[model samples]
Target: MKSRAYSAHTLSALVLLASLIPLASCRTAPPARPDTAPSVAIDGSTMYCTISWGKRGAYTLSGQAEQLDGSSYSVTLERLDWFNNWQDGWTEASVPLEGKLLLSEAGGSWTASKIEKPVPARTSAAQIRHRNTILEGNQAADLFDRRLERVRATAAWLASESSFSPADGNQFFARAGKVLFPEQNGYPEGTGQSAVNAEFKAGEGMKWNRTYTEQSIPEHLREVRDSGTLWRDWEESRELFYIAYTWEK
Candidate 1:
């Protein structure tokens, strides 16, 4: 157990750490889209797959384009495999990097109009202790290039009606979960999809229920477990945690 004095010191250290970090190093806007047809096209003819590396870490971006109509297409993209490079090797970490893009045809050429925003990447309080300002402007630029290229390739694959295949996010998640948690049986009670959905519906009338999925029950449980207060808290306030985790961020 952490002493109250130690906890107070930790809080002070976190405050100081936050003030020391530079804003630019912590967050950045996505790179600008090139004006060329190939870079913005949704005609199913170009695809790019590439890795972007920075002093702090590396990530990969790829995408696919699906023709929605004669003038529009839907593009799905993924930025995956975030890794922090260290002296020894690399450490895998979760980072938000999946999104969709909408494109429209104009002047006999396809062009992307907007891209859906993915969930924001976050740094945990625990991580802030050891994290440094990341130099990643070039990395973001590389991701932009790779996204256009991959979209082109996937669009090319869909050029022929016989080859058209749409991407399904849920199916992808199911397959990924199998590989990531091979031994996992199922979600805990009240944590299943339907149960969680019902919990949300019930909380729709509650003023305090600011629906968000970032603060999930599993994450809460993991935090408490790491802090050696899981069992104690579970017995004292399990239901409260469940409802709070279910309906609020």
Candidate 2:
């Protein structure tokens, strides 16, 4: 009976010790670390950093420099969370730091390391011109002689009370003795035409007789003429027509 009791107690002790072995191993093991530093690059105004851990996962840190100093920049980092959604992370962190930083597996939770200075990408002149063109609302120099011809033809059509034809393809037209100019790409199209129509139909005769001369030209148009690169042969008197007529009695 005594031998049996001792044997039972020993069996219980062995089981408890076996169970605690795994817990002790877990406590003694160190936390996993990344194999290498993050990769960093810059494009335009944005900076990107890529970091990876062995078998754990990989993540990217995107940042923008809000302020630039000598050899360093105050950057704002955007990181992806565990769910892989982008969110704002650190703000105004000095980058290109000298030491390692603790990065958390969860984004926006860990400290980021310093990155190398980024090189500014070169932009082409043609790209600049295209961007400017878009910003300028697509207004180009209407220096073609056909523009004046179209104006004259529209004036004739208005006098004769003829139906407009799509074949004419004239950009400018006249109705009720009011010479109309189409809006440029950047400018509101048909707005000028609508205003002229409204004025012509109000009451009876012509309300205003306006002339567009060199002195009357807008500053931008004059600049276009001076540049002579985009447009040429701007003759205000010949291109712009005078409309003088009263409503029929």
How does each model score on TM-score? Answer: 0.23, 0.17
Candidate No. with top lDDT: 1
lDDT, model 2, position 242: 21
Measured by TM-score, the strongest candidate is 1
Query: For residues 9-118, could you state the per-residue lDDT of candidate 1 as single tens digits?
Result: 33343233323332433332121112223223122345322222221222322356565666566667643333332322222322334666565657755444345643
How many backbone overlaps does candidate 1 show?
A: 10
1-249 per-residue lDDT for model 2 (tens digits):
001012343334323322222121111111112223333333333333323221222222334443233233344443321101012111011112222222232331223343432211111110001211211111211222233333334334443443332221123222221222221122133334343433221112222212221222234333322233212111222212221000000
Q: Give, for candidate 2, the lowest lDDT window spanning 10 residues.
A: 82-91
Global lDDT of each candidate: 0.32, 0.25
| Predictions: Cα RMSD each | 20.0, 30.0
Clashes of 2: 2
Candidate 1 residue runs with Cα over 4 Å from true position? 1-38, 41-61, 80-96, 108-110, 120-249
